[model samples]
Structures are given as C-alpha cells and as structure tokens.
Target: MARTVEDAAGAPHILIVGGGYVGMYTALRLQKKLKRELRRGEVKVTVVDPNSYMTYQPFLPEAAAGNISPRHVVVPLRRVLPKCTVRKARVTELNHDEGWAIVQPLAGPPERIHYDYLVMAAGAVPRLLPIPGLAENGISLKTVGEAIHLRNHVLEQLEIAESTDDAELRRKALTFVFVGGGFAGVEAIAELEDMTRDATKYMRKVTPQDLRFMLVEATDRILPEVGPEMGRWTAEQFRGRGIDVKMKTLLVSAVDGRIELSDGSSFQAGTLVWNAGVKPSPVVRRGDLPVDGKGRVKGTEYLTIEGLVRAFTAGDNAAIPDLTQDGEFCPPNAQHAVRQAKLLGDNIVRSLRGKALKPYVHGNLGTVAGLGLHKGVANPLGIKLKGWPAWFFHRSYHGAMVPTLNRKIRVVADWTLALFLKRETVSLATVEQPRADFELAALDGAGHRNAERPVSENAA
Candidate 1:
C-alpha cells in the first residue's frame, strides 16, 4: 500500500516509529548532530506516531489535580523536531525483510513506508486485568484525555455529593477508590484527594470527613521504588489524612459500580480509577526482532537489537541490558528511558558514519513521589526524604525534565498562580453527553409539546 517512490534520493531514509520519550528525543538529537548530512540530502528522517505530541508522564498526576495545565504537559512533536518529517499514524505491521512497514494513517488507506534504518520506541499500553466491569465502568489516568476526564469527573462527583440528601447515595458519590499503589495510582489518588478537599470548602453540605478515599495494593507495601522503610512512612502519611491504605488486598470485582475486595469487603462507588501497570505495545512483535521473555525488544548495551544492525529499540518497549545489575534488564521508568534515548541517538549516528559505537550504561538514581501539595517522599542517592523537602525535590526534578522551555514556563506559572488563587472546582460533565439531553427530550415528546404549544398560541 506504499505510495510509489519516484526517487529514494538521500543519504539514507531513517524512519522512526513511535513518538514517545525515546523516539522524539532521539530524532531531535539526530536532527542537531546530523544537520550537515541532512542538508546534503544524504539522509532524510521521518517520525511516525498516532499522537502528535509526546506526553511528559511524570506530570500527569499534577495535571489531573489541576496543579498544572494539561496543555503544558505535552510537547508537540513537529514543533520540537522541525528537521524531521512527522507522520500522524499508527504502524500496523513491520516487514523488516522487505524494508517496509504498514502504516495506518489518520486519513486515507493504509500505506507502506520504506526505510533504510528503523527505530522502534512505540512504548507501552495499560495492563488491563479481567476484573469485572473494569473495562466499562472504571477510568484510567494515563493519557491527556483520561487525565482531563478524571479531573472533571472528580469535581462532578463532589457536585453530586453536595446536591444529594440520601446518605448512602451521598457516600457512594463521594467515595473514591484507587487500585495500584505504584507512582501512578498513589500520586493520582493523593492529588485528587487534596483537590477535592479544597473544593469541599465551597460546598455548604459537603464536608471533608464525609469523603472517603481508599488505596488498594495487592502487595505488602507501596512505593517499592523508595524501599521498605520509606514505604511504611508513606502509608503512615496517608493514614494521618484519614485515607484508607489496604495492603495485601485484591480487587475481585467492580461490576455495575459495586466493588468487592478479596479481604471480605465490599463498597459501591460511582467512580473507580485504575493505574495498575503497563505492558509493552504489540508493535515490537510485528518485526522479526529479538525479544526477551517479557515480549520487549532485546537490545544490547549499544542500543541495537541483536542480529539487526540497522534496527534500534529503546524506552519502555525495549528490554535493555542492565550493565550495573549483572544479568538483569533495565527497569521501565522515565529515568532509564531518557538515558537510553540519548545513547541510542549517538549510536545511530556512529553507525551511519562508520564510527565506533559506545555502550549505554547508567546506574539507578533513586525515586521521587509527590503526595499532593507540600507532601512527598523520595530516596535520592539512598538518602530518604519526606514532607516538604521531598515535595520540593519532586517538583524541581520533573519541572527540569519536562520537554520544552514553553511547557516548563507554563507549568511554573500554574504553580505560582495556585499559591494565590483557589483551585477551579467546575466540571464539564455535559461533555460526556453533548446531545443526550436533546435526544432524550425528543423521545419523551417534549419537543412535540413545545411545537404544539407554539401553534396553539399562534391560532389564538
């Protein structure tokens, strides 16, 4: 389905699939380092992804809580990687032997794209479980759409709690449940809980005590990245705020707004947020690439896939060798993903110019987590931090890491305004059903009633 190539004129056409952290950054660095080659028509670069922007995932929780503007957390691919051709499409299949891939663009028919070199950094998707009703009733906080949905949904729930007189119904509407104690689940729940508490101040009927927040983790502790001691301290911090932290518990069911836990507990809630974990995207399997047991592309220390010199992989989708950990692979995190991308880009350039390649190696730097405003925990260089200092470190680290200067400035501005202005509590729930009211009214004869009333008035 590829468009006929009138000419394959260039140094070599390099096609990068996926526009996540690794893909976008690799292309950006390539455009800078290989500018001369690009200008000479020696090489042409193209980056393809279903999304036009690369989301700085670390700031997602803040965006969900309205602490940062959602727009500021995403870096537009084309804007930053101007030297590369950005294709807004999803790669359906890769024929490495044929030197082409099947791409399904946003419009038109599927087409084949030819490439001399391929870089796979398609990233991962949310690891969904078979828990009942999760796919239909539960919401996720991974993407921009999901984050905005959660923000508006939380505020809408508070509004519902304020208007209801039935105690049981009010409790159900106010109660929020989060599954998974990892960074995503814990941070999102903590931030949204903080935002909801602040919003309750404007409600005459709703009280902070009336709202219930629950965190469910199947393991013995939370925040594995911070070690056991800090994890225990984090649990204590949440408990101090009246937030229930359930450890060693499993979510058995959540069908029809009813949640049943493995610990012989049950609750009904209008909203459930799931942030369990992620698995590598299926795109890696499309190519005849070496993969590890986890289905991630197996990459050497130099970021090249074994037996595939022209193909490279990195980020969450690549199982890179952990040189520091003996035989283990690098853990999937932004820390490793960013470093891998830089090394991958350098190796790509070296290969193109017939230069020696360098190995990608970096030791773990520790972890950080933000628990709402002025509350956080971190284990930077094995020195555990808690309270306000940890929160400051978390914000500073992520603010510095967020892609462009424009986004960084906007995020900082949002934080500054938050100090003086109250958080916005309005929810646009009608967004979920823009035309539902009119459709329902038409079916109920309200539209006919209005039409007949106008005719009768005119006749009179």
Candidate 2:
C-alpha cells in the first residue's frame, strides 16, 4: 500500500491525476525539484492513474508494426517515481473548492483524496462516432496492449486468408480499412502494411497482390501537421504502393463487416482501425474548473487553471494559451504536452516557495512521422525531409524522448536487433482468450467439443 496524507502526518499533499506524458513528467520533475521537502516529510506527492505505467504514445505505431517491443513503450510508474506515492485508481470527480477528489480504484468503493495542489493531466479519450457496427469492430492504437492486439490481429487475418478456400472470406480477410489520416491512422496503416508485406514472403498462398489497404480521410489531405506539400507527397507514396487513399471521405457505416463509404463504395474488411481524432476527457467538464468550447480545462500561460493558482493542468485536458501564437491555444500533441509539463512542474514549485511563475513560451518545432522502415516525412526547424532522412530523424527524436534510460536502451536495442533478425510475424491471438482451452477441458456435457462461440471481432 502507498502512503497518504495521513501517513505523511498532514504534510502538504500534491495530487496528480492521469499518469500520461503530462502527469508522469510533472511528478518526475517535482520529485527532483522538491527532493529536500520530500525527504524531510514537509510535502507529499501522490499520482493517481488507472494504469500503473505511462505509455510513450509516439512509438505506439511502431509497436503495432513490431518495430519496437510493446513493453519498451511503457514506463512503470512505481519504478520511475519511487520518491512519490503511486495510486492505481481513476480520479472520477474533482472538487477544487474543497481541495478533494473522488477517486475510483480498480476494485472497492470510491475514496476522497484531499490535496493542497491538484494537477489535472488526465489525457484525451477517443472521439468515437455512432456509426453502425463501429463499436463491434473498430480497434484503436492508443496503448501498448492495443498495439500488441493489433499486431496479432493483423497477422491472424493473414492466417485466415491463407487457410480459407471461400473467395469472399479470403477477400474480407485480406482487406484492412483505416479511418482518419492523422499521425495515428497513417503511421498505423503504414507500419502494419509493411509488416504484412514482409510476412507474405514466407507464405506460399498469400502474395502482395492479395492484400487490400485503404485509408479514409474526412479532410482533403492526410498528415496536415507536416504541411500540405509533405501531406500530398505521403498520399502519392501510398497510392504508388497500391493503397487506396480516399480524400474527403467518411465512413458512413460498417455493418456486419461491410463498410459503406460516402464515396458510394462498399466493401468487406476484416480489420477496421479507428484513429478518428480524440476529445478532452469528459471528467474535466464535470468538474467546477472553467473550460473552453471544446471542453478542455482553461489554463493560463503559466500552466495554472484560470483563477486557481494551486490547480495546474496540461496535456490534452488543458487549453493553455500558446505564447508563440497571438490568439491560438496550444495544440494537443506530445511536443506541447511534454514541454508544458516541465514548465508546469516548475510553476508548482515556485508557487510553493513564493517565487514568480514563468510563462511557457515555445515556438513550433515542426513534426516528424515514420511511414515505415526507411520511409518517413519530417519538417524539423523549418527544414523539410522525406524518405530515409525523415525516417532517421523520426527514430532519433522519439528515441531520445521515450522517457527513462531503461526504456530508451530497450527501444534502441529493439531497432538494432531488427536489422539482423527476421521480422517476427507470429500471432498469439489466443492470448486474448486464455480460458478457451481450460474451459473446454472442464466441460463434462455433450456440447464440450462443440460449444457455441461468443460474439467478438475476429480481427482484434
């Protein structure tokens, strides 16, 4: 069990909610800045997150493509923040007026955790639509677990396509549809497609021609973050590789594995990867904190909540004014999330010791995205790069930013070994249902060998 304010004998407690890039980085900096205070028990830091680890989301696409190990993408909270108390729970409600938050643990009843300082770093959730059959079939690439599942699911689809004699079943198995053309969707499809292409070399029945990859973007272009020129180049590259890039398209429905598009095309796809944007956590709206029209907590340039100096917020949940821009808020990305977190930590420390808080002011550093191995696009420091150079830049930037030397070494090691070893394409899909074999053996009735199957996506 972790220590609480009572265990610290009424020390000033700092509560951090949601252990993502913002939450974890803020606590880490605080641990360093307040070392003496923590050692002398003058202050206590408690981080509450539903998960015990922080995921490096930038490498999630690579993890899905098996370019990086799934475990290497996540930093263990307890291991990283030893000086602070780590509570594996979700902060469902916050009462800033009373300095208490209602946290719901994985099990047991909800508990109120009081704090002198609060950090609302709870990141965004997927902005899912009410499209038909989407909830039943869509897969997301947000976490390491989801990345692992997607890798396995894509490989399993190949296996199904190879074994099935039914042409329609094989066609569906080979078809993979990805929604959204942002970083998540584009990189996900690119990596998985590369993996599938490599896996086909070992299979006699399946070939590159048998595969069908489609990318649906509601906007006119893909990867708008990297400029219009690069986005057009990326779309052209995908089209050159025989991928169908449908711009200004919307996924109307996906009922019973059949995809209906706004372009008047219908097809059956075994995989439907949904990377359709994200919205600020709804929990922020439910709280008393002031929010913008988009439901993000309104934060000042100092990274503190509006009118509440003790309350800090960053990442996807906070709409901090971009000092570099005249009237625009900071974009919700890893680049801003990480930089804001460091500044937020310093501001918190300043508030505790009667020092002036510094406003966060950083210009856009440009963007880098990996399409696959030796294939990418980047515009770092206003310099445009494509192909191998961009790919190298992407890896170098993310490799340096993956948090903790332990994870850094592991991620780099994965890349190094990939150059020498054959790509591992085996799918452990059964891991999703570990009880299948045990339950079959335990059954004593006549339907033991022929049990009715539960309804779930075969893709993931």
Candidate 3:
C-alpha cells in the first residue's frame, strides 16, 4: 500500500483514469457543466493517465497511410480539459473498498489518491496470441506511434526490394501479410496497399504487380459490422485489386519471417501486421469491483458500475448493458464510447446535484469504413451506400467528431491538400532510432583514432 494523499474536506473529488475517448470526453463535459461548482471549490475533478493526449482511433488508418498527419489524430488532454487537474501517471492499483488508488508516475515513486467518485476508462490493448515468432516478429496497429512506424517500415521495405538483386530477398521484401479481417485489419491493409501501389510510380524497378498483399482471416467474411452482403462486396473488391483475400484460413506459424498457414501454404514476408482483436485493460479487474466472464467491469445502462452508484465506466473496458436491445450489451466502438461518455457526464452532474439519473438507450446510428482514397462503404439510418459517397460520409462523420476545432481544421486541411497533391512516399525509418546515426558516427570516429595511434598505444 502506498501513502495516501490527504483528502480535502467538504468538496467531493472525482478521479478519472485513462485519457482516451471516455475519460477525456467525460472530463470535458464535467468541467463545462460544473464550472460553478469547480470555481466555488464545491467539487473537484482530476484526470490521471499514462499519456497526456487522447487518440482519435478512427483516423489511425489514415494516419498510417500518410493521408493525415500523426499529430493531428491525437488531442492533448491538458489543453482540452483546462479546468480539471491532469495528472500524468498510470493507476497501478485500485482499492474501491477504501476509496483510494495507487498511481505510478513516469519518473517518480508510486503514490495513492483518495476520491469520492471513480471513473474507469483504461481502454483496450492488442490481443496477441501464443504463436511461434509472433512475440518476436509481429507488429500491431493500435497507437499513433505504431501507425507511424508501420508507414516508415513499409516504405523502407519497398526501397529494399527495388535495390536488391536477389530474387528470394526481393520476394520476401515485397510480400506483406495481415492476420484478421476486422475493421482494423481491413482498413490498414487497404490503405497501405493503396499507398504502396501509388508509390511504385516513382520507383524505377518496382511495379505494383511485384507487391503481394495477403489478408488471412479465420472467419468466412470481413467487416461483419457492415452486414453480410457488404462484407462479400468488400472481399470481392480486394480480390479485384490483386489482393489475396484468404478466407476461412488461419496462420499456423511465422517462425523467422517464414509464414505457414493452416491451408498448407508457406511463404516469406517482410511485413506481418497483427490486428486480430483487442482485450480490456487488466487494471479494470485489479480491484474487487464486479466484472463479467470476459474480464470487463460490469456497467448499468446509466453508465455506472453495477452495485456502485458513485463509480462509472465506459469504452472498451466496460460491459454496459444495451437498453435498446434486450439481453445485449453495447459494442466496443468509438461511436458508442463517445455517446456513453456524454450521458455519463450529464448523469454524474445530475447525481451530484441530487437529481434523478437517466438511462443510456441509444440505438446503433450507422457504420462506415474507408477503403483508401474515395473508396468506402456505409450503412447510415439503414440506407446502404458504396464507393465515393460512403467515403465522403466516413470522412465527414469522423471529422465532425474529432474533438477540438483546431484538430478538425488540421485534419480537413490534410485531406483537402491530399486531393490535389501527389502522394509522398519517402521513408523516415530513422525516426524510430533518432540517435542511431550519431552513435554510428561516434563509433567510426573512435575507429579512425585507433588506426592513427601507435601500435603500443592502440594495444593500451
């Protein structure tokens, strides 16, 4: 147990964990609604997260494809929630029974904080499986950093294939495999394949045909959220574009860059992207709070944790009941997360003021997915759209929902410029190891000095 900070008397303190969709939005609403309470010191709000920014995950594929700047996809938490106290730390332990949590800061020892209200929105992490070489070689597409790195890595592989004379090496460098057929996997592969094909126009030796993109899905269809007909259409579109959509197939092993599939196929790939799925953050189960069999904290339609009126949870980590559909729960997606957060914020304010709380009962509005520039699918209000119109709708909806006006302008500007300008395909892989060049130079300088020195001096 860490030393608990002395709780200030009179005012009730609200402590929120994680700065992603739910936490950020909840804080934003609370700060705006409780301005008078906060100013008068009648109530307090503090947000604790490992990162200071909230990533708009819907734009991650675009960011990875270089359609949008990586910086524009993330909103700074402190800048957005100026009225609330933003603590840059991760909650390592939670003891709801004692009304305290142990938080570990990036640079300091752990400390405990006490609060009257709690909000759990730690979000989810990439669901990795126990397959050979996956832990060593596979890469994920969950964060802004990962997306940028993937872009650099893909471009670098293309350069390698273009310069290499060895046919096997070239083949390996040109082959890209993606496991899973969910929205993340589908969008990532589509955007990257489109970008790579467009980039080949500038290469002297590499052509779009040389690139082999494979999507391995255990399930029979992709993008189940878009319904069966749309999923079939998506697969057909991918196949027509020269992408190998291997349905009802599984990746058996990927040992040392060599991929073996359940269908008795083996191949070498330079890039292996894993977007299988995501699991709830483990911290949600650290306390005695009730959780379902899937490890998600149980939540009521009111957005409050079950059996705990003062505690709230939303987003990927909470299994909140879906009131619109009997015996069902809300799906873990940005649309639901954002809406639940707004309602939760209002409910919390109402609860604080001794008012009756309302239940969250919003039906599924729609679903949209972008398949690279001007290609998309959407089912809004039961009206199915395809191609350019769907793509336009996808951009419009997300652009409108991307937090602040500053980011909205930046994202729109990036899209607007991309329409007229030629695609930029330069690889900056060195950004992953910024100090590598300086370190190599230092080693070379040391070698040169050693060579110039006398034999005895060198020996010494």
Candidate 4:
C-alpha cells in the first residue's frame, strides 16, 4: 500500500526523521546533489521535526551565558533546504518495512507518510534517572530552549535573593547546584558562575563572593575527554574561584528544594541543574529499530543500519565504531556528528545510484572549553593551551563552526559588542509567558473577559 501510493507520484521520496544536526545536513546534501531532480519533482525530500529549525548546540552554553543571542544559534530548515519539504511535526513511529511513518502535526490528527528512503537521524534526548523530584525540579541543557530558560532562571534567582532580607531564603536563592561534572555540566556551571558573579558586583546588597556554587560529580574526575591533567586543572581553577568541587559524589535526591548527596551531605539549594548524560531518543525504540542495549541504533561504518542499506543513521542515534580507537564506538559529540552527517549524506546518494559506499572515519581534532571571559582550557591537536590563547581559540573555533554565514557573523558581532559594552544582566524571563499581561488585563477578576464574544469576534 505504501509503495503503490508513493509510486503514483512517479518519484522517489526521501523522508528525514529529525530536523537536528544530521537531518538538516543530510537534506542539504541531497538538495545539492539532486538539484535538477528536485526542480522537476522527480525526487522529493521531506524533513519532519517538532521545530522548523536545526540548533547549533555548541553555542548553547554561550547563548545561556548571554554571550550570543538565542536567535542566532538555530537555522531554519526551510531556509537551508529550499528544495525539500520541511514539515513541523513529530514522528510518532516509523516502520521501514511498511515504507511509511506516522507523524503528528502541531494541531492536526496523526497522518501516515509514505517514502522510498528513510533517514533515522532522530538524535538523542536528555538521559533522565528515576530519582525523586527529578521530574519536578531538575533541568537539563539539551536544547536552545532549555539553555535560554536556564539563563533566565539563574538571573531570576539572583533577583529573588536580593529582594529578600531573610538570610535562609537568600542563601537558598543564591546557592546553585550542578550535578554531573562532564563537559556540559562543567562548562555550564563555569559560564553561569562567571555571569552571576560578574552580575552580583553591580546589584545592591549582593557581592560576587555571596554566590555559592557547587559541582557534584559521581566520578572522581570531570571532562575525561580532555584527559585527566586538564580536567584536574579545570577543577582546580574552579576551586580557586571558591566554587566547591565535590568529586565522587552523587545527588541522591532534590526533594522540596532540599538536596541530599551520597556523601551524607545535605543542602538547601533552590537551583539544581542536571547534565549527567544523554541516551538515544526513545523514538528509536518506539519505531522498533535495531538498537544496542543503550538504545543507540546499531549501524556500520558506512552509516547504514544492519540489514537495511537504504536506511541511513548517524549522530547520537547510531552506534558506529570509532576507527581511531579499537573496541570503542564514536563518542556522541558535535565534531563526530557533523562529520558523520556529511558522510551519511554522501552514502545515501551513492546508495541510490548503486555506487560504492565509503566508511566514516574522523579523528578528534582535540577539545577546547571556555571557562569564562578570557579564561579557558584546550588540548587542540595535542597542544595543551590555557588562559587567553585557549579562550580565544575556543570562541574562534565555535564561531567558525556555527552553521550558516548569517549566524556566524551575528555571533561574532555579539562578541565584538561585548568588549565595549557590559554583558546584558537583564533577564527577559517574561519571554516564557508573553501573554500574561494581556491575559490579566482581559480578565474580570474571575473568568475571561470575552467569554460572551461570538465565534467570529473571538477569532478576530
């Protein structure tokens, strides 16, 4: 039924499952390779995602730190893939054998889509643990939305702390706790601390030293990707700044703003940020795709799943071998994901033409992290760099890598302005609820003010 329906169009249909790093790049590659076919509608490409844009996640930390505007970190799929159909929908399930997928749009009923090719680049979600109060209070930095919200929430906490005279309330408000000492947690905590500490210097009754920051790591060391020496150096730098680094510690619970740790320590911290880890998107399992124990799709170096050559997978979703290191899979990082998407795209095009497939192989260029402002740590190309050079390199590398020329320019522009101007400490938290003022004004102190309006008036 699916094949017959798609065959009626007299063209091959390519369906991309996610509008993330892999999905966007794959569609762009297809659009470039089959430009003539796309013009004639001989080959149709469709990308379905909840958001119409692909977010450059590396810039997320800076975006949250207000070093870059939130608007510049995301690329609109429609703008990038003009030749492809960009559908703002969530793929509920995909059945490759049936050659069809069930997708739910923003407001419409679920619809079945038939396609000749499927790209399982659905990406990963924040790995959540079954801990109490986690669902209610913990925050993860997986999306640009989450990053921006965290920025606002952190600044708002400062506001709460300053407005109150209660020492307990102020301590609770001023204290910030970050669980997971990986790159995400370390960078986030570092950037946020810098921002808050700098911000505190100007606020009334608040000193930079008043803010209490703590990092809780289950492992003895953080940022194992950069090697132990560098990780320890990074941790030492944090400790020098008076930030507590609790190694080999775990967050047992965060119930009712009371945080309990595995080391028998307890604290009343109002903010709890979780960046422990990530697992493959649950959608992979929902679709019944072949995945490893960790829920990552099992795929070969050619970026194709086992027994399904036509269907390609990459990024965090697929568990492809790391040729650089024996007996290990590719680390789920931006560098590997971006490189994999480029090769995955070419492999898909080759598969269509019955051409030879090339295996994906890319070595780590090295890791660079911005501690804050002019402070950073890096191990780029095996050269260990610290202080200004690493910090500048960190900014420059990420600035160059952020997708699209428009965004790259804007991000640099934001940085350039920062040198001459102060970092914007104003928290536009109201962005979360833009209609609150309107809703209040349009009320009668009981119910909605326009309840008696006709359908036509309400619509207007």
Per-residue lDDT of model 4, residues 13-69, tens digit only: 888898898999888888888889889978888999999999988777888999889
How far residue 62's Cα lies from its native spot in candidate 1, in Å, is: 0.7
lDDT of 2 by residue, 219-246 (tens): 9999999999999999999999878999
Candidate 1 residue lDDT tens string, 372-452: 999999988988899999999999999898888999899999999999998887888788889766554444243343443
- After the best TM-score superposition of candidate 4, give how far the Cα of residue 10 lies from its true spot, in angstroms: 3.2
**Candidate 3 residues 74-131, lDDT tens each?**
9999898988889899888888878889998887678989999999999999888899
Error of 4 at 233 (Å): 0.3
- TM-score of each model, in listed order: 0.94, 0.95, 0.96, 0.94
Clash-forming residue pairs, model 4:
none
The CA lDDT of each predicted structure is 0.88, 0.91, 0.90, 0.87
Candidate with the larger lDDT of 2 and 4: 2
Candidate that scores best on lDDT: 2
| Candidate numbers sorted by lDDT from highest down | 2, 3, 1, 4
Clashing residue pairs, candidate 3?
none
Q: For every model in order, what is the number of clashing pairs?
A: 3, 0, 0, 0
**Model 1, 285: alpha-carbon shift in Å?**
2.2
Pick by TM-score: 2 or 4, better one: 2
Model 2 stretches with alpha carbons more than 4 Å out = 1-10, 448-460
